[model samples]
Target: MTASYVAIVLLGAFAGGFVNGLAGFGTGLVALGIWLHVIDPLYGAPLVAICSVAGQLQTLPAIWHAVNIRRLLPMLVGGVLGIPVGILLLGHMAPDLFRLSLGLFLIAFAIFMMFNRSLPAMRWGSKKTEGMVGFCGGILGGLAGLSGPLPTIWVTLKRWEKDERRSVFQMFNLTILACVAISHLAIDGITVAFSQLVLIALPGTFVGAFAGIRLYRRLNDHRYNLLVLIMLAISGITLVVSEIG
Candidate 1:
């Protein structure tokens, strides 16, 4: 790759990683915007998906010790069930609709936090709730690759410890990434161009993941809240504008 192209990819990956560390989200969206500048915007979904899954793989080991296997199963079950349909809709649906929906929901998440004094830690719920969250969350995860929101909200509602929430969310996303990557590879076959992009992104993603993991350790609630709001506004505006166009 040319130096200029390499620079773009590295910048995107680093930004994505840092954002994930600081805010717990935005890596995909931020990476999407950054790469779109160099690559075709239509390629954003698959491209981000690849880097995202890679970044998660890197982070999962750090948080692997506390993964609460029993609690995680239902979400995975739900996510798996929804993946087929979600993938099918990826190319067919309007990107703006998807993005705006994400924006509004993110804003709502910030609202949920502002009204409450505690983070969601509602780990005590019925099997039915788990199943419901899993099924719906899976679909979102498979489709837009942002299934962490509902589960994150669920954790927040239960008032989980910050570490527990981050650990679990990290695991949840990585799991979704694995499943989605398989589908992409098995069904679509990673094309030559996409494969090249993936290679280009690897070094950048590595640096990003390293930096992000460091930040993830130091982040707290207030800063987390601000980051979430900013992401929501930015993502929302993008979607809203995309829709208008």
Candidate 2:
């Protein structure tokens, strides 16, 4: 890769890791777009998968105590089950249309969350519900390397506490991303460029993750909710532009 490309990858990694650390998700949403400028999505998607796992691992120490194993199990199972289906559909599906539709939906949903004060919490946010959401997340993850949105939106609507949200976000993302990375690697043996990019991105991931954890620690419930909504809006716009551009 050229020097400029290396710089772009590193910059994207830091920014993506920062967002992931802060919100427990969204590294690909922020970073893949940047990396796509330097590399093709075929390679970029796997790079995102590996780098995102690294970023999530960085924040694990801080959020480990908050993880709810019971709540996470169903999602993990559902996500795993959905992956093959998503992969099967990837080449045949019209991703641009799917992404545009998803982006608009996220944008509209985030707006509602931002303005509405009386929105009711999902009292029935049970394991079944989480599993359905996770299945959708896995499908998206397999199809486009974007899995964080559905779970993030679900937890946000459920009005989960900061810790609970982080726990779910971090663990859930780590699982799906790892699965995607492995699947990609199994199909396409790791290239020299991919290995180099992963190495180049590691430092940024660690640094940004450290900073993000600190910021996350200081946020109250209200601030956390606001942050998630803002991120959802930004991610939605990013997806739309990526599809259309």
Best model per lDDT:
2
Off by over 4 Å in 1: 88-99, 118-124, 221-238
lDDT of 2 by residue, 1-245 (tens): 68898899888999889988898888877887788888777777788788889989888988788887887999988888878878889889898899899899989999998899478897876779789888988888888777888888888878978888878867888999999889889999988877888899888888888888899999999999999999889888987987888
Task: Count clashing residue pairs per candidate.
Answer: 15, 0
lDDT of 1: 0.71
lDDT of 1 by residue, 1-245 (tens): 68898789878988887666555556776787778778866566667767777787777776677678897887777777877777678788876677777767766665656677555445468867776786777778777776767776676566555667666666676677678777667777778878888888877887888888887667675565455556655665655666676
Tell how far residue 245 is off in model 2, in angstroms: 4.0
